[model samples]
Target: MAHFDASRMLSFDLETTSADPMEARIVTSALVSIDGAQTDMLEMLADPGIEIPEEAARIHGITTEKARAEGQPHDEVLAETVRRIKKAWEEGFALVVYNAPFDLTVLRQLTGSFTVTGPVYDPYTVDNIKDRYRKGRRTLTDVSKHYGVTLDNAHEATSDAIAAARIAWKQVNKVYPDLKAMSTDELMEFQAVGYYDNQENRRKYFESRGRDGSSVNTSWPMQD
Candidate 1:
């Protein structure tokens, strides 16, 4: 197995206006590039052109007034965000995200023209696959805590993104050591296949429990 370099990865996360990716507008986002002992971080806040809901604001602490007054225009934010992400991909940095589907879906909705081409590393999905029976919660905070990584700010995009990268690094070194052998492209393929496999298993589990399984999405990155 080839040794993986954690510092070479790019970690991304988003804070949105709501829970539903399709309807929610991205309020803030962070992209962090880790290189050796150095780290570069970019953060963007978009006005979203809509009122930020009270509950959502309570969660992330970005109120509608704050967003409108301080955030950049939605289109401009989306364009720059897509540009940076694509640049990172072109530079061959493996993308690490925490619940990638939600963020990727929101990104697609906002950018419309951008497509997610991966070698993506989703720590959420990877953790589920590695420890299917570990109960309670699988949220970014929970996962970080499980991996003994400190997440100082829970809802903030930059903190969450960095924590996710750290958790993924730990998981690779501790749980799925064999994955170290795979190149980023190979890792991406593995994630795609594993996503479908896990979806199928979840569908079967729901069916066995006489629950509706149709809502379970088979797609990775986004549901179509």
Candidate 2:
């Protein structure tokens, strides 16, 4: 395995008002910067400007009342979050998101533009690609446990983000060792190809299971 400095990574996650990225608004988000043994984290909560459904609130524990009372406005929070992510990218930190499409797509929709550029590492996609034969669910928590990373508070943004970073670290050592040798731009290109390939594979899997694979999105970063 190639050795890489962990400090040159940024891990991020978002808790949203709903499961559908196009419809949901970000309720909470976490951005973590890792460097060796040192780490910095920023956590933000935003008022989504709509009623948070009970089921969605139960998932992440952020109700509309709590958001309205304690959170920043959506626009301000989103702008600042995008600014931080862009800054991290420009500074050469590889962005590590647990599930890149959901969070990145949501961010793109909220900002009305593509704000996060990377060497973006989506542990979800990478894990799926690396372990296609593994059975059972591949949730972040599941993959983290499989990789021997502790993920406390599964649905919470900060905890999930940190866990994702740790999982990516472990995955690189265990599976995608070549990733360590790639430049940020090259890794971005690699993921762009891998994302679509995985999507096509997933579509075939669903179709083989007699499910509707047509709805599966082939787009990465954002579903077109």
Candidate 3:
């Protein structure tokens, strides 16, 4: 039962062309590593080989014109992103993702072989479980503000990745220190189970209201 080393972490985030991971095309991607005082980031932008929607461009500030001029080849960026994520997992670093399912599922769909065998630390899931009764929305922005983690550039991949890592690090070490003592596998199960239960409860609530609860798949850390 290896324990999660909160002192060291690797996080991934992506700014894309759409909201749905299934339909999104990567516009920017980041793999950030945080160890003690040192932080390193591998950030990349892709041309996406398609038009960037106005809404998405507004969110991430990656215009179609800008991406086409400066971004790398779509295939190259996608493959390299997956390669580095797998490599980081091989190096015993827990993957820190704000919303694990969105970015990871995008990578999974984009690179067919995008998969991991190591522990994953999803702050989004952790925050939802840890503060299940919190009133406001649990978006990255909301959680960042609630935790007092700075998110100056809300939609950028690198900034979002770093913010997520800091938020989780703080949560485990400061807010809910008991989580720091859980085994690596235990931590994974905690998020997995918590997310599943939360989603199931939400589904029941929606169903009770006579709404379609099936739209939101209850799969944790992945869409399907």
Candidate 4:
């Protein structure tokens, strides 16, 4: 079991080179203080082991030339990112990813292709995507609109990560009324077992994509 602390949550997001998280390469990533006081940005040119599509480059501004010129080695950058996140998780921190399925799926995909040094904070994650739809909203943009949070530069990871923190802080308190009263451990337990049905759209997505058949990273918990 695990726990959550508002201050210990690391809201994160990644900007990748493609729409399919399983195949995309992370061009940039950002982690923001759960309290919204400070932030850190890690922008890198991922080798991607493939060509960087022009459309994707236009989205996050990471071109192949730029990556070859200044981006850290892909494996090194990934190892460090996992290391940092794992360090925080070991300290009782829970990561707040807007859509846990997308980012975590990307991470697992990358791990299958490359060597990742440590575990990511997936089990203790709060999925804002699932939460939003459960509340009858359509998208992150819709939830952001409802919460009055500024969503500047929607696709970039840095902006998205910060927005995720603000979103989590806003929604958790609103939907889970006793969030503050629960200890970090209790909060984690609550989120892990929380009950809410999926929207029809998501159910259809899983059906069409055939992605709901089985758990992918079932053994991640035992990884070092």
Predictions in order: lDDT: 0.84, 0.83, 0.89, 0.59
The clash count for each model shown is 0, 2, 0, 3
What lDDT does model 1 reach? 0.84
lDDT of 1 by residue, 118-178 (tens): 4678999888777877988988888888899999899999999999999988878877887
Q: State the lDDT at 84 in candidate 1.
A: 79
TM-score for all models, in order of appearance:
0.93, 0.92, 0.97, 0.70
On TM-score, the candidate that comes out on top is 3
Error of 1 at 60 (Å): 0.9
Residues 106-176, candidate 3: write the lDDT tens digits: 98898776775888999889989998998989888989999999987899889899899889888998999
**Candidate 4 — what's its lDDT?**
0.59
Better of 1 and 2 by TM-score: 1
Candidate 2, position 158, lDDT: 93
Task: Count residue pairs with overlapping backbones in model 3.
Answer: 0
Candidate 3 clashes between residue pairs 3 or more apart in a chain or in different chains? none
Task: Give the least accurate 10-residue stretch of model 4, judged by summed lDDT.
Answer: 215-224
Candidate 2, poorest ten consecutive residues by summed lDDT = 1-10
Could you tell which candidate, 2 or 3, scores higher by TM-score? 3
Q: Who wins the lDDT comparison? A: 3
Instruction: Rank candidates by lDDT, best first.
Output: 3, 1, 2, 4
What value of lDDT does candidate 2 attain over all alpha carbons? Answer: 0.83
